[model samples]
Target: MAKELSVEDAEKKARELLDRRIASVRTLVTARQRLAELREQVADADREDVRLYNAALNDGWSPDELRKLGLSEPEKKARTRRRAAAKKTAADAPGVDHQEPAPVPAPEPS
Candidate 1:
């Protein structure tokens, strides 16, 4: 047997239930927004990872085919030329010593 409630009690119970439902909906909405923010952050990190990987590929070392003995002649010649130029520059500069001489200490008096 169901107990009959007065009009005022029924209205109050309905208002409380409605308030709880509204709060639950608000919590769900907040959780969904947070999930969306996390997804965007993950997407941004993925984009940056791809960018870094591509940059590394573009600026990285040569392939094995390019490192063969006969195939690397031009690179060797360019490196040699650069080294010669650097040596010439160092030789031409005055008051600049390239060799490391022995360090001399002050003589201690008795």
Candidate 2:
């Protein structure tokens, strides 16, 4: 026959389980944060590579050589869209006339 645990012993076991649960939750939170940081680092690296490729192009690097770096088409498209959005935002500045004027009709040529 097993002996029943005393109240004090039961309380201690409950506290221990609670502590373990708290530690597990903390570990899980830390792991999630680290994963997010790693993902951000990867994105930053990709942007850096794109910037470097642009610089090399300006410095007369061959397109074939740049292509060898494994930049995918989707990545290029995303970069293009990002650049266009940035330019649009900049052009839509406060107090600036954003609307284009109608094209002036040229005088009829003889």
Candidate 3:
């Protein structure tokens, strides 16, 4: 006859598996929160990168030399206006107030 698992043994096994799952989920949550924070930091760093690149260029550093040093040209920041204004863009709604243009005159016969 086969022996059945003891109650103590079953509790130990369940705790082991559930603990592992909890640890993994905790790690994932921590990583996702850190990833979001890092993204904001990276965006701030990009703006600073552009500023420093421009300063170096103004300091007489040649573009070719900078390229050889592996520092590529930084891109311009996209947000020229305030945050609220930037977010409130034209949402591709249809233009209902349409106006007709004047008709062109036909050429006289030669």
Better of 1 and 3 by lDDT: 3
Give the range of the ten consecutive residues with the poorest summed lDDT in model 1.
Answer: 69-78
Largest lDDT belongs to which candidate? 3
Ranking according to TM-score, highest score first: 2, 1, 3
Best by TM-score: 2
Per residue, candidate 1 scores C-alpha lDDT tens digits across 20-65 of 9999999999999999999999878766765654554577635444
Ranking by lDDT: 3, 2, 1
- Candidate 2 per-residue lDDT, tens place, 1-110, comes to 99999999999999999999999999999999999999999989878878877888899867776667764322653334334444557668888888889999999999
Q: The CA-based lDDT of model 3 is what?
A: 0.87
Residue pairs clashing, model 2 = none
Q: How close to the true structure is residue 58 of candidate 2, measured as C-alpha lDDT?
A: 92
Residue by residue across 1-110, what tens digits does model 3's lDDT show?
A: 89999999999999999999999999999999999999999999997898899899999998899999998888765767655544433453466435567899999999
Question: Which clashing pairs does model 3 show?
Answer: none
